[model samples]
Target: MARITYIEHNGTEHVVDVRPGLTVMEGARDNNIPGIDADCGGACACSTCHVYVDPAWVDRLPKKQAVEEDMLDFAYQPDPKRSRLTCQIKVTDAIDGLVVHIPEKQI
Candidate 1:
């Protein structure tokens, strides 16, 4: 399991352990972390689960796929270099200390 940190736009932080094989979106949903609406339920069909990866982890995480990249365009105030769809990021030991910042709102 990976211990992921979800930081809200207001600075509130939620740290949770996410099992391997689950997406980061699932981790937040399971732990009741606010800000990740997951409107598409991990299907990568919406940008409600958008987040900005912590700079330190930007290169550590897997590269974003084309679909995720396309969907990010609809996210609220997306940052080209940091924005990602939580639904597209799977949990793993390599990402044990991953940190993601939730945006002020979803689009």
Candidate 2:
């Protein structure tokens, strides 16, 4: 399992141990973190699971695919350099101490 930290818009932080083979969105949802709505579950079809990867960890994550990039256009307050769909980020040992920040709202 990897140690992941999720920070909310209000600065609330949640640290969780996430198993590999699951998406970061699943890590948030399964741990009961409040910020990721993930309306479409882990299908990568919704922007509700949008999040900003910490600058330090951004380059460590996998590049977004075409489908995830397309959906990010619908994310609230999208930031091309940092915005990402959590459902598109698979948890792995390589990202052991990943950190992500949740936006103020999902809609």
Candidate 3:
């Protein structure tokens, strides 16, 4: 299991043990973390699962696809450096301890 910390916009944090092969969105949904609605269910079609990867971890994630890059355009909380759809990030040993912060709103 990998330990991931999900912090809400208000600063509350939910740390969860995630299966290594699961998507970050899956981990959040399975753990009942409040902010990541993941409405499109990892299909990369919705921005509901938006999250900000801690600066230090950004370079460690797999490169985003063109579709994911385009979807960021629809994310209200979009930040070029940190914003990412949680569904696109996979939980793996390479990033064993990842910390993601959630925005206040998701639509």
Candidate 4:
């Protein structure tokens, strides 16, 4: 399993173990991490799992899909360079220490 860390806007951090094929959103919601409602689960329909990937790790993940790209428009903390839908980020060794930050609120 890969270790994923989510740092909240106020600096609180949540750590969880994730399976290789699971999406980050799944790990968060399943593990009961805060701020990730994942109302649409991992279907890429809701922006509730929106997060900001550390700039250092941004290039290490794949590009978001059109569905994720579109849904991100609903997030309260959208940032073109950093905002991403966590459901679109699959677990991989390259992201074992992956740390994404959740904004204070979601739209």
Best by TM-score: 1
lDDT tens readout by residue for model 4, 1-107: 99999998899999889998989999998898888888887788888999999888888889877888899889986998789998899898778999899999877
TM-score of each: 0.98, 0.97, 0.96, 0.94
- lDDT string, candidate 2, 26-77, tens digits: 9999999998999998887889999999999878788889998999999999
Selected candidate, larger lDDT, 1 vs 3: 1
Provide the clashing-pair count of each candidate structure. Answer: 0, 0, 0, 0
List the global CA lDDT of all models: 0.96, 0.92, 0.92, 0.88
* Ten-residue stretch with the least lDDT total in model 4: 37-46
Residue 24, candidate 1: C-alpha displacement in angstroms: 0.4
TM-score of 2: 0.97
Tens digit of lDDT per residue, candidate 3, span 3-85? 99999999999998999899999999999999999989899998999999999899989988999999988887699989999
Q: Which sections of candidate 1 miss by over 4 Å?
A: none
Q: What is the lDDT of candidate 3?
A: 0.92
lDDT of 2: 0.92
lDDT of 3 at 19: 95
| Runs of candidate 2 exceeding 4 Å displacement | none
Q: Clashing residue pairs, candidate 2?
A: none
